[model samples]
Target: MSKLAWLNGLPLEEAKAEFLRCCGSTRWAEAMARARPFKTDTAVYSEAGWLWSQTSTEDWREAMAHHPRIGDVSKLRERFKASGAWSEQEQKGVQGAGEDVLQGLADGNREYEERFGFIFLICATGKSAQEILEQLRERIKNPPALELRIAAGEQAQITRIRLEKLLTSP
Candidate 1:
């Protein structure tokens, strides 16, 4: 059966678990499960976007907690074991990076978190390590208010991609 059909048919508790795996927000997952029986893949994505927009700063932070630090290969393998496959796929760009670039990313991640009180977030799906590093360098200059919004936007993009993945998976 198709994934969309599978999602449409799952029980509420099971569906909430699946959505949590995709987005990592209990509220978002519960809201999605309550909005069930989605008629199409687009409908699922639409609802995801809407629900995310309705979420709070704390909710965004909760979702962000689900991701491992970028360039942190050990955490990607161990800390994020629940989302390890997806995280690895999303960060394919970092896999073959040079050590200097990796170290730069690690250092930048530290500085970003220290400055903003949260991890640096980027979509990172198709970006190269150098490209991601450049983005990090630039975004780190932004003030906290602006950077939090930027991070939330990136998380929204990630949620949309994961939602698409969920519906397309077998």
Candidate 2:
């Protein structure tokens, strides 16, 4: 059977677990599981977006907690072992980054967390480290309320990508 079919046929708790792998918010995962039997990839994507928008800041923070700081290879391998492989792939640009760039990312991550009270989040799928750093530099200047929403929006994009990966990965 196809992946979508497999997902649709899973038991409720199992389905929630799979959805949780895509996005860490328990509320979003539970809701997505209950909204199952999606007819098409587009429908799944649409539902994911809608469900993410319905999530609260606390829920967004829960999802954000799942991601390692960009360029932190050790954290990716050790702390976030469950999602490490996928995250490593998404952050491929960091693999060949120079020491200065890596150091900048580390410092920026600290500053961002201190300011926003959460990790800086970006889609990171196809972005270079320099690009991500530039974005972090820019986005860090936003006010707390606006930055939270922007980070949540980035999480939404990440959820869509991970949903596609979940459906397509064997």
Candidate 3:
């Protein structure tokens, strides 16, 4: 019994709940649940990509609301408990940084949110805290529209990672 097999076999409500854990947008989760019985892993990933593209800015913002600010480890662990250990794992690179680096990330996150009206989202899986901060500093220079698109793209990458985890988890 593979994870995808388990996912494909889940009841509709349960499937929706699981998908919600992957991406916080209700629309994405609902669309994923309705697109069930995916025969292949690629099909699942394809459906997720298509649905995310079709989603509106409102839906993207909804998903963004689910994440903590970058470097906010306490909030990541305590507030995002619904996502369990995944958030903490994804942000592992920032776990034990010097206060100066953490403070830089924190300040950059604030400036980014003030500019773009959402959290600074990045695929932080393997990025170091300094590298993440550098990316944020550079990205903050983009115009609002461009930055929003970049954030959404980063969220899409995160969605893909979570989906892969779902399929691979025992």
Give the Cα lDDT of each candidate: 0.89, 0.92, 0.91
Residue-level lDDT tens digits of model 1 in 1-170:
88988988999999998898778788998999999889889899999999989998888888888888888766686787667778888899998999999999999999999999889999999999999999999999999999989999999898888888887766
The model with the greater TM-score, 2 or 3, is: 2
Higher-lDDT candidate of 1 and 3: 3
What local lDDT does model 1 show for residue 154? 96
Question: Best candidate, TM-score-wise?
Answer: 2
Positional deviation of 13 in candidate 2, in angstroms? 1.3
Clashes of each: 0, 0, 0
Model 1, position 14, has a per-residue lDDT of 94
Residue pairs with backbone atoms closer than 3 Å in model 1 (clashes): none
Q: What TM-score does each of the candidates earn?
A: 0.95, 0.97, 0.96
lDDT of 2 by residue, 95-139 (tens): 899888989999999999999999999999999999999999999
| Per-residue C-alpha lDDT of model 3 across residues 65-161, encoded as one tens digit per residue | 9988888888876888777478888889998998999999988998888888999999899999999999999999999888888889999999999
The lowest-lDDT stretch of 10 consecutive residues in candidate 1 is: 73-82
Tell me which residue pairs clash in candidate 2.
none
